[model samples]
Target: MGYETAKDLTAGTCGGIAQVLVGQPFDIVKVRMQTSPSGTYSGMLDCAGGILKNEGPLAFYKASRSSGTLTPLLGIGLCVSIQFAGLEYSKRVFSSRNVASGTGDGSLTGSQFFASGVIAGLANSVVSGPVEHIRIRLQTQPDKARLYAGPWDAFKKIYRANGIAGIYKGQVATLCREASGYGVYFWTYEKLMEREMTQKGIRRDQVNPAKTALFGAASGYTLWAVIYPIDMIKSRMQTDGFSPATGQKYKSTWDCVRTIWRAEGIKAFTRGLTPTLIRSPFANGATFLGFEMAMRVLNAA
Candidate 1:
């Protein structure tokens, strides 16, 4: 009953700044690891350290003469806004129905909350699929002899190649990741934050940015735990084009997943886990904290 679209948008847009700011460096490393040919780096640290040493610190931001430090900023903001909007809308829809979850007490039960999160994730994929598509294509390519000149160039090239469909290279994988990952993501953090609120005798606003950040971090970790493998496929599918490696082209998401597992074993599931773990907490933590604060203010107003 209390959720508002304005509140969600305001919070999500605000939160996105922190999300990108804290996590961009680590994300660059993660993307490289995910898209690299098999037997590229020894591990996550090796990949990151090598990039730092060879490409210099600016490499972490995916910057160049044309692109700036703000990597995927709008993409993150759009995803958050769409995801939160879907979550809040779904929760509102279920708030009046005494279905499987709570008794319409205005407080969502665990299952209901999870369902809302999945819905949010699906909605987010609608925007995220293309946004990430461009980002990854540009990011994974080396500066010299790159396919697309820049993000705009990549967009045009992909559009020419396969039109809208090409722009959405990994929608299925993104949907899978968002649906399941976000389900556990919000449920874990929301449950934890709820317990903290109850035990600590604090209101939602009283939770403070620090605790909200911590909850956000927890949510990020929980999502990645479930979605890393799917995310690996999604990243691969997006960056598949331009790779010189033989047999890199995947027929489908399942095909990609199968081939990865068959060839690399289970470790393929978590190739870039180290950088991801390092970035998730800070990125998600700051994002959630910023979001909470924005929502508190906007909801009150």
Candidate 2:
């Protein structure tokens, strides 16, 4: 790969690590709230308290230790790397195309940014779908009624039970969530950062780290707001049982949506949104901060 691609990948890895460290606790709560039966816990606090009380504090980082911290830490790290790398590459491609066509300057337009994000998100879902599936299974599994021993075990068992399709339980939902979500995610961040730089009369790299983080947080909020219902569906689909013994929950993506709408109300689409919103700011703030810092160091090097 080129130097720029390598830099983006490495920086994205840092951002992913920062995100998981800051967000895993809230993630567990969010997953539980999303996948659990109604009335599992009253709200975010109750869900968190229940996990702490019943499962211990370490329970929050459920599958990290399944095989020496490789599942989510490595999985998500790699996924984020692909996301940033794909985004930057797509942006460059679009910018070059626009310049060559004499349609605009080299700098990307807002629509270009959104399109780049959509491409990146779609690329990311290839790995993220299975990674998140494993994570959701581990997170929502009852502490006392554990299914798989760890991430690898879960993968093996699921694959053995249902083949390749089993491992990618929520692939469709993941694609939908990532496409629309990251379209908004990158567009929001770029607009916010661009406005700040314009106001300060500074270069993009000269913007304050604090402001970068705030922009990232804002992007995270907007992303989730646009895609929370899709996310809820993805979570439920990923957490659904795939074993021949246990059988499947919903037949298909449409089936899952119809089930949620019929059994629960439209309000159910917002389930677990609280913890997600709470987690987004801190997690995405750390993400952009970590990414930008790493990028600066790489550039200097």
Candidate 3:
């Protein structure tokens, strides 16, 4: 209920900024692995090494043009609006006023948090589909391809090629991913935080940055580990060519999953996992910290 208010918008935007600043470099590596059709660098470190060796260290930031911050700053904030707001709405619907107020005999149940997370995750996918489509498209293309010159150009090309459908190429994958992954993410974080606060006999507002970050990191790692395969399929689907005759690598989500498995086996599902797992602790840790600090400052003012 605390996050359901208008202040979450401002805090969420700043949180997203923090997330991108810390996480984009790692994400570029992850996307490269997920979208590389040619099997381009061997693994996460190799990918980083390859970028450093051939494209220059600066090439890592080239995906989003001058700034690696653009996509996450815009995308994460917009996507999380529903997450924070819907969490509050779900709490209202499922939990009694007493439980929401933390005045009841028992604390909020795991089921309550899970229901809220599902609502939030499903909400996130609606925004995530088009946003991530533009992001992955920008990141995946080889340096030579100028088809999507920039975000606007990417939008123009997508619209011209397939109308509105083009912009949402991987909506199904996104829906599946966010619904399941984010559902666990929010539930895990909230449950962890509640346990910690209760154990220490501290109020929710008394949560330290370190504790918040720990919970956030735990939640992020757990969620990604479970749903990463879905993310790979989504990236492939998004970055695929507009033409089905020659450009389509995957006929559908399941087909993409099958093709990747046949081509690379179980390891395929974990491509770029090292960097993604490494990045999550930093990214989500900073996200929660930034959100809390921003909320405190803004609300106090």
Candidate 4:
């Protein structure tokens, strides 16, 4: 396909937004499971059970519906804008270096690919921090009644409590998380699909939608598997509050890991993998499919 930066950007934005809306409830549950590792729940199934037994099925979903409505509205811009920008930026870097000439690698190196991921993540984080803050707080609120009556209430509370910064409480770590996380996610997914197509003697452009969706799901699994540990730390920093100066709260990501290891042990990092493992592939598959289709439809018009 032709690479048009504007078209790519539009598609990315729309896709990211749509994905988040459909999946934020799971997002909320995922966060709670990650952050509250030592709580009553053992795995996603257990946590889900608690929500169902005590709070009911709707309760398992909780504030997601509301948070979904608002967060993705913002998340789309962050996700799509960053992804498009990252691609263009990387393309320029490759052209300038002519890096592929001698190497004959034919695509960006792993490091270059990683760099693009960071750039995309940074872009996503700028918008995501505040929106995510609101999203998490809303989703994990003590009770349905305690949940922000609406996004407006959540916004006001954040502003009133912490000024502008409150809305984006864990922005730095968030940036790190999204940048690195998405960076790896996209690069891995693309590389994997490329390999799969080549191996199957399938034309890249002619890949079937079902297989394509499976590829997207595989990518999600790979992305999460690689980044889930860092994600665990990010969640702690975001919800529990961390001190950047002394690194007192969670400290460096390693420090956070060590502390959790001591306090909660190995099981700590993978707490919510159960539901997430179940939910993420389908969600991500839908997200990729929806995003690509949206782009096609929009471009066609």
Highest lDDT, which number?
2
TM per candidate comes to 0.91, 0.96, 0.91, 0.78
Q: Is candidate 3 or candidate 4 better by lDDT?
A: 3
Among all windows of ten consecutive residues in candidate 2, which has the lowest summed lDDT?
Answer: 62-71
Candidate 4 lDDT, tens digit per residue, 136-170? Answer: 66666666457476566888966875688667766
What are the per-residue Cα lDDT tens digits for candidate 3 across 77-116? 7766556666656766666755667767545678778878
Global local distance difference test of model 4:
0.67
In order, what lDDT does every prediction score?
0.82, 0.88, 0.79, 0.67
Q: Tell me the tens digit of each residue's lDDT in model 2 across 35-123.
A: 88888889999999988898778878766345434567888898888889989899899989999999888878999999999998999
Higher TM-score: candidate 3 or 4? 3
Top-down lDDT ranking:
2, 1, 3, 4
lDDT of 1 by residue, 1-301 (tens): 3447867876888888778888888988898998887799998878988888988887887634357565477778878878877887888787767544555557678998899999989888898898888888777777666777777888888888678878988889998888999999888877888898889998888886787888898889898989998998899898775333433478888988888888888988888888999899999998888888888888678
| lDDT, residue 269, candidate 1 | 81
RMSD per prediction, one decimal? Answer: 2.9, 1.5, 2.7, 4.4
Q: Which regions of candidate 4 deviate over 4 angstroms?
A: 1-3, 53-70, 73-81, 92-110, 144-147, 196-204, 241-259, 299-301
Which 10-residue window of candidate 3 scores lowest in summed lDDT? Answer: 62-71
Q: What is the lDDT of candidate 2?
A: 0.88
